[model samples]
Target: MAKQERAVRTRKALITAAAEVFSREGYRTASLTVISRLAGVSSGALHFHFPTKSALALAVEEAAADRLRVIVERCEKFEQPEGPIRLVVDASYQVVEQLAADPVLRAGFELGGHTVEMGSSGRVCDLWQRWVASVLEHAQGAGGLRSEVVPGHVAGLVVAVTAGLEELGRRDPRWLAHPTLTTFWRLVLPQVAPAGTSVPLQFAGS
Candidate 1:
């Protein structure tokens, strides 16, 4: 049991170290030597856990996907009462918060942009985009969206805007801050929500 627990810890450490290196240096340039050293593990341990850089990156992205799902699920559980638009707005804020605070998620999102280099087909952005689209479709059926609003269009816009914010936030943390998303939601919610619906126009806590 103790050996298994230590192995788990070693794997997590390697993933975290890989995420940090990948986040800073990007996938093509990130070095396994640096990742293993940063993880305080030997090269053999890293190899034992992840065989190759692509495998390590995949692990990082998978970890990020898990975190993203948790954030979405959490927002859905508490923010649904306010309506779909509210849920989206809150979820966006939470995502940005996680992006700001979690290197694994940030690395996953960044690595998603370099799928060609990694030869990986999955993208974290695509996952988020599909989720947004599905939720908006639900909103349309529930009469929460404006009569003329197309859920796909709204989802596209939302996903694009958030993707831009994520890219910009990579260089400037201010881009990921709460006020930035609040301002975006403020401008967009009015256009998306049905006429005269009393949707709350603030972040989850504020």
Candidate 2:
């Protein structure tokens, strides 16, 4: 393989290995030696791709962010005839499902909260909040929000609830299930969606 292609594979391998270690052992305890061993790459090769454990963690977090962006974008494609509120709900549900299945994404969120040890990768939870707020703001601009509802407040609530679910999922895998998220949206949609608008108990494309 060419140097560039080799580098790409090495980097991907390192990130994947890092995700497994971080998810299984967490930021403080996960070792680069184990990560290199898991990737079946030499220590030099791991260093060539990620010079430090923090660098590898950052890479994993970046990949997770990209995955989340894809999730939200996918929700945009299947726009419900109902409103933007439904779009946000579906998007949030998709993220929960993705988090449950994808250990990499889950690890990204895990490492994100470990900023004290992981350097300055920033909080993935903050990214999640901003994304939720942006989606809710779109709904507000489209007049889909309830007359009494504040878009920012609702967005914060969504972030807290989803984060709580993700945290719970760390302990009990069932917290990441479809019914768990659907139950959340089922309660949220009725309050946020315009009065008399029949928000489905189950989200579309669930």
Residue ranges of candidate 1 with Cα displaced over 4 Å: 116-122, 204-206
**Model 1 C-alpha lDDT per residue in residues 14-33, reported as the tens digit of each score:** 98999889988888999999
Best by lDDT: 1
Query: Candidate 2: misplaced stretches above 4 Å?
Result: 116-122, 201-206
| lDDT for residue 165 in candidate 2, whole number 0-100 | 81
Tens digit per residue, CA lDDT, model 2, 50-161: 7877788888988888888888888888869777887777777788888888877888788777654666545667788888888788888888888788888988998787
- Candidates in order, TM-scores: namely 0.92, 0.89
In angstroms, how far off is 132's CA in candidate 1?
A: 0.8
- Among residues 3 or more apart in sequence or in different chains, the pairs in candidate 2 whose N, CA or C atoms overlap within 3 Å are none
| Model 2: per-residue Cα lDDT at residue 160 | 83
